[model samples]
Target: MHIAEGYLPPLHAVAWTAASAPFVVHGVRVLTREVREHPESTLLLGASGAFTFVLSALKIPSVTGSCSHPTGTGLGAILFRPPVMAVLGTITLLFQALLLAHGGLTTLGANVFSMAVVGPWVGYGLYRLVRRLGLPLMVAVFAGAFAADLSTYCVTSVQLALAFPDPGSGVPGALAKFGGIFAVTQIPLAVSEGLLTVLVMRLLSQSSAGELIRLGVFARGNARQDGQQGDEQGQDRQRKRVA
Candidate 1:
C-alpha cells in the first residue's frame, strides 16, 4: 500500500517514521552480515530486491487515494528472512518514490512500516507456522505470500482511518469503509501474488537447490551429508596422489 504524499498529518508521519526507524536500522545490520558472511548471496539478494521492485512498481488505483500492488516481500522474507527483506523493501519503495513517482517521501515512513516491516514479518511468521504444522512447502509459501500482501493493505486501512476518521461513525466506521473497499481488489491480488510466489519458489528449488540448502530453506541434513561425501572424495584424491 502506497499512501499518497502528505496525505498523512504531520504528527502521524513523525510517529510512523519513529516507529519504523528501528526495524530499518536492524535490517541494515542483518543485510550487512549476510553479505559479509556469504559473498555468493549477493546475487540472490539482488534478485530478491529486483523481484520486489518490479512487482510493487505495478501499482493499481484502489478506493480512496491509495494504491494496491503485490508487495513481493514474501519471497525474500522466506528465502533470507524478514530482516533482509526489510532492507530490500525499503530500497524498492525509495526508488519508486524518486523514479516512478508512485509514493511520496513525506509518507515514506508509513509506507515502509506497512509494506516493508509488517508485511515481511507476517509472511515469514506464517510460513514458519505452516511448515511446523506439517504443511507442504508450496502451500506454506502461498499462505505466507497471501498473508503478506493482504496484511499490508489492512495496515494501510488502519493508518488512513486514524488520519481521517468518519464524521458520523468515527474511527471504527472509517476503518470498516476503507477495509471493505480494499478487500474488493486486494483479495484477488493477494491470491495472485501467492500463486506467483509459489511458482518462483518452485523454480528456485530446481535451480538454486544448493543455495537454498545453505540458507536453511531446505533441510540441513542433506547439506551436511553432501559435505561429508565431498571430504571423503577429497581424501581419496589425496591418497591417490601420494601413491
Candidate 2:
C-alpha cells in the first residue's frame, strides 16, 4: 500500500516525522476547538477519519508492486479545511499501520507527510483557487479530488526515488519510473474518486445542507467576492476601451 516496513531510510523517516509534528499539533487544536465550540462537529470529524480509513484501505495493485488507492483526504479538507484534516488523516494512518498490515510504523511518518499533509493541502488549495476563478462547486470538487489522489502517489514516488535512486540514471530516472508505474493504477482511480466524491457531496447537499452551511462548506464568501471584483475590473476595462 505504501513504501512498506523499514523500506525508507531511517534518517528520512525521522526527518519526515519531525516535519509533520507541528501540523499535527495545529490540527489537534483546530479539531478540539470545533468539538468544544460546535459539539456536532465531533461526529463529522470522526466520520471524516473513518471515511479516510475505509477508502485508503481499499488499495488497488500497481505494476510496481506498490498499491494505490483513493486518499479521501480531499473531501475532508474541503469540508473542514486542510489543518483539521491533518489530525484526522494522521489518526487514519496510525490505525491502518497498527491494524491493517497495509503500511508500516517505520514509514508512518512518510505516509502521514504524503497522504495526510500534502494531499489535503493541495486539494483544498486547488478547490479554493478554482472556485475563486468561478468554477462551479461540483467542478471545483472534481478537480480537487482528482488532483489530490494523483498528488499522493506523486509524493510517494518521490520519497521512494529519493531513498533508492537508480544506479545509472539517478533520482530523476527512478522518480519517473516509480511515477509511471503508479500512474497506471492511480489515473483511473483519480477519476473514479472525483466522481464518487462529487456524487456523495451532492447527496450531502440535499440531506445535510444545513450542517454543511453551518460548517462553511457552502459559504463561497471569498470566492464570490473575488469573482465579483474580477468581473468589475473586466467591465471597467471594456468601458475604457469603448471610450
Candidate 3:
C-alpha cells in the first residue's frame, strides 16, 4: 500500500524523513561495502531492483479502496542481504513514483521507511528466527512474509495516526481501524508472498547459482562464507594499498 503525497501532514512527513535518514545512510554504506568487496553483488542488486519495481507495479484492489502489491523485499532479502534489499526497495519506490504514480514523490522517504526498511528487516529477522527454531522452509517463509506485511501496515497506520490523531480516537481505535482494514487484504497477500518466496528459495537451492550461494540468499550457513570472503577481500585491498 503506497501512501500518496499529502496524505500525511507536513510534521509527520518531516519526522519520518528524519527517522528514515539513518536507515538510508546505513543502507548505502552497507551496499557500498558489498559492492566494493564483491563486485558481482552489484548485478544481483540491480536484478533485485528491477524485480521489486515490477512486483510493486502489479497491483490488485484491496478493501481500503487502495490497491495492494507485493513488496518483493522478502525475495531480495532471501536472495541478497537485508541492507541490499533496502537499496533495491528504494529504487523500486523511486521508479514506481516516477512512472506509475503508485506512490508520491514527496512521501517517497516515508513509504520507503515503512515498506523497504521495516518490511525486509522484519521479514529477514523472522526468517532467521524460524529457521533457527528448526522449522520447515515453508513455515519460515510464511512467518517472514506474514510478519513483513503486518509490520508494514502497522507502521503505515501509526504514521497515519500521527498525522491525523483523532481527538475522540484512542490507540485501540486506530489499531482496530487500521488493522481491520489492512488485514482483509494483507493476510492473503502475505500467504501469496510466502509461497512465492519459498518456491524461489527452493529453486535457487536446487540450481547451480553459485552467486546466490555466495550471497547467502538461500542456504542458511552460506552467509558466513560470504561475510568471510568479504572480510578477506577487504584486508587484501588494504594490504595492497599500503604496499
Clashing pairs in 2: none
List pairs with backbone clashes in candidate 1. none
Model 3, which residues run further than 4 Å from truth? Answer: 58-68, 219-243
For candidate 3, write residues 156-195 as lDDT tens digits: 8877766666567876576677778877778777766676
Identify the superior model by lDDT, candidate 1 or candidate 2: 1
Number of the top TM-score candidate: 1
lDDT of candidate 1?
0.82
Question: Candidate 2 lDDT, tens digit per residue, 1-243?
Answer: 366889889998998789888888888998898799989878887887787778675655544566556688788788878898889888888888788776788898898888888889999899999988988888999999888887888999999999889998999999999998978778877887788788767656545544566668875454333222224465465446445
**Compared to the true structure, candidate 1 yields what TM-score?**
0.83
Worst 10-residue lDDT window, candidate 1: 223-232
Against the hidden reference, what TM-scores do the models get?
0.83, 0.82, 0.81
Error of 3 at 83 (Å): 1.3
